[model samples]
Target: MSTPGEKPDTRELVEADVVPRSRWRMQLVWLVPIVALLVGGWLATKAVLERGEKITISFKTGEGLEAGKTKLKFKDVDIGVVEAVTLSTDRKHVVAKAEVVRDVANLLVDNTRFWVVRPRISGGTVSGLGTLLSGSYIDVDVGNAVKPRTDFVGLEVPPVFASDIPGREFTLKSAGLGSLDVGSPVFFRRLQVGQIASYQLDPDGKGVTLKVFVNAPYDRFVKGDTRFWHASGVDMAFDTNGLRVETQSIVSIIIGGVAFESPADSIEQVAAAANAQFELYATRADAMKQHDRIVDKYVVNFIDSVRGLTVGAPVDFRGVVIGEVTQIYTRFDPEHRRFSIPVEIQIYPERFTSRYQTGRAGGRISDDPKGIANYLVENGFRFQLRSGNPLTGQLYLAMDYFPDAPKAKIDWSRSPPELPAVPRTLQSLQDSVTRLLTKLNNIPFEAIGNDARTTLRTTNSMLSKLDADVIPRAHDTLASAQTALDSANSALQPESSLQQTTEETLRELARTSAALRTLADYLSQHPEALVRGKSGGQP
Candidate 1:
């Protein structure tokens, strides 16, 4: 249909179209560099935000940590990832290089704590149970300080969860370290509410010092007079009451625990502040024993034998326990060459203070230290040792009205006022015997023997007369009576009732005489007993 350049053919001819290979190259070619730059810049920005900060952490051992796999967590939330794990150049420790997100990187402060979290059964608690399936992870504890840090040292054992809890801490002094560990549970009425934070030997080496933490609401239960004791493991004991086994829980039986209770007298109490000091008793009994606060101490020097007296013996006031014996020892006086038993007693004056009413124009103690002792002295107060159990020979000190007690005064110069002591009951008996012997030694025995010999002579003379005269007459009468009975018997039949009766009467007479002789012999051997009944020395 196309025509040549002739004018006539112009109407029927058409020129061929000129089309480029592509036109898209022109518009998109410029856009290629711009889009690429924009995309590359976006990727760079993502890398900067997500790439994280690389920091090394020193561990006792690499343990469950791995490169690019172990993740760091805070409060169970993922916060960082481990990039690499390797042993230090010296091989003294393992160092892990971890990448922490920028958001949490500032949390890496001097006070921050980190440790590997794994399946652990500690302090009566089972933790990290999820690690059983998903494997172990690094646990982090953040600090309030925002000062930036990179390098860190990890805790071999995870820090106690109680450290992160909102509560108060206290110090417990114990006789010695028992089954308690760093993470031992602290119990309130056998309920798990806190934990033992740490423990160490006391500086004076007298006991162990323990640091404990109690969680928020439970911490309020800690009053100024709270008492703490080791409630760890199984307490198995056999006493007069029989077998007793106590445990806070099954977990406490295995891993140990600590427990606290309000003081015996907590009528007026206040919440104890953090770092308050308390005594951690060894057992429940000891803890209860500590319920009484020591208010007074006294030393009683007794001249009597302290055989049954021992430490921990009860000290009573009118049969009511007011104190306990703390010590009993004897010291020899070099100058006098005499030994005296010094017994120490701790008195709880609070007992009397609680009994009296306040602000009623009532009796009040004097400022003078010897005021009470002086008043008691006027009231016939004296200390005496009495038998608590005669069978066990256990003796306890008793303080009561002893009006007849020898007048004495307490020596107040000593720390424990020294109240004058009297001899024990048994000692008093021995003293009485010694005094009797001393008086008997002064008697004129020779003159008394002469008088006794004279009396014996007179008694012998009377007996001789009775034997010489009364015996002949009595014998002749008996012969006469026997002759008469024989004559009567001959008159009667051989088996007659009169002959049988005569024989029976003779036998009875013989028995009576024998009994009379035995009685006379007994009287002669125990002349004083006839008047004094019987002596204790007699069988």
Candidate 2:
């Protein structure tokens, strides 16, 4: 320091004390760098915290999906965005990568549904129209499952009902899936109260099973004895009541639907539980038929033709259906060497008779089917076939009293207990015609014609005799009678005995001659009167 220039000798003498700065303190220039480092670190941490969960959804096709434009929505609210769309390794599906808000991470469960919401029409429903204007989006239906899932298979078709809808699910087993499909309406009293949720063929492939949802208040109407039927198209039926056309609504007719009703007697029954199973009948009449517990089977052998009578033909008692034909077959009798049609019918006694009789002790036709059957059979109760519909030529079996029918007895030992059956009306008419023809055939017409000819010849001979001999004689007698009348006129005198006698004699002779002429004329005209006595009339 002393070796510096003379100017430095003056500056250097003032030896400034260099202070040691604290390690924790920073210089003003270092403050800017430190703040920048802290700011950068905070920004990195915030980026990590806001990031959401990543999910991948697989779809059959990516029709409306976009990498960055499509958004994920639940209940019409945006919850995520699609990041990318790519084909699967197998190229059979379109895989979409998405980032959903962390709040919904737990909701991504196994049953959670994902589908592209686009304008669509299915099962007579128009949906996703709003998505058309807003662009297509990924719709989600959160499931009620606890199992978490990140990978999902998207539905090509959207669900008919959301999981949050207020309803109860039920199952129906049908021999076939008529016109029903997802979104098909279900009606109660012609009011739409539910829809078909889904359907699938049964495991055995013999039938189809449908899952239906009935919303809140209408669900309460389903009872233990509730019946369901196919109410899709116009249900037309022809029975004793004549033509009946039944339908639920125009919407149902178009898309197809189901209808249900609880029997009046089942109103007091408990409501059916969720997922309750029921049998779907083909028609309302079949579904509403009262279930019979007591059935008695009897066979009827008919010698007449059984045309127009089918197995399902109704067995009627006084205009009421009490049974049905179950089987019809030809039976050969070994001893009689003839074929007879045997008809098996199942009768429900409860349809006609009360369990307990009223008014009198023996009025009830119950508790003893065999005895009652025997009693009825002995007292003119008979079965007859009658035309049910003249237009269709359908015949049904009828049971009624026929007091004038010939006596018949039932052989109780016979299997199925044969019930006496009379011929149908047409068959009876045919029998009567055949009997009349047979009687006409037995008449001796040729012999009667010969006898009539013989009688005619005899009468002709008598008339010829009268015309040839008696007529001329009657003319001569009439001439004599005229001469006698002239002579009597000449001999007549007042109170002379000879004159009086001659006048009386002439009067008697004139009467005899007139009688002879009248007899001759009668025999000439009425020739047949000679063979038999004349009737009380002029010839």
Per-candidate clashes, comma-separated: 1, 0
Candidate 1 per-residue lDDT over residues 328-432, each given as its tens digit = 988798998899889999887655554445421222244554676777876778788888876667788988887777888877787878887767667889999
Q: Each candidate: what lDDT?
A: 0.82, 0.88
Tens digits of per-residue lDDT, candidate 2, 167-214, equal: 799999999998888889999999999999899998889999999999
Off by over 4 Å in 2: 1-37, 84-95, 329-339, 355-365, 404-417, 472-539
Provide TM-scores for the models.
Answer: 0.69, 0.78
Pairs clashing within candidate 1: 3-13
In model 2, which range of ten residues has the least summed lDDT? 355-364
Error of 1 at 347 (Å): 3.5
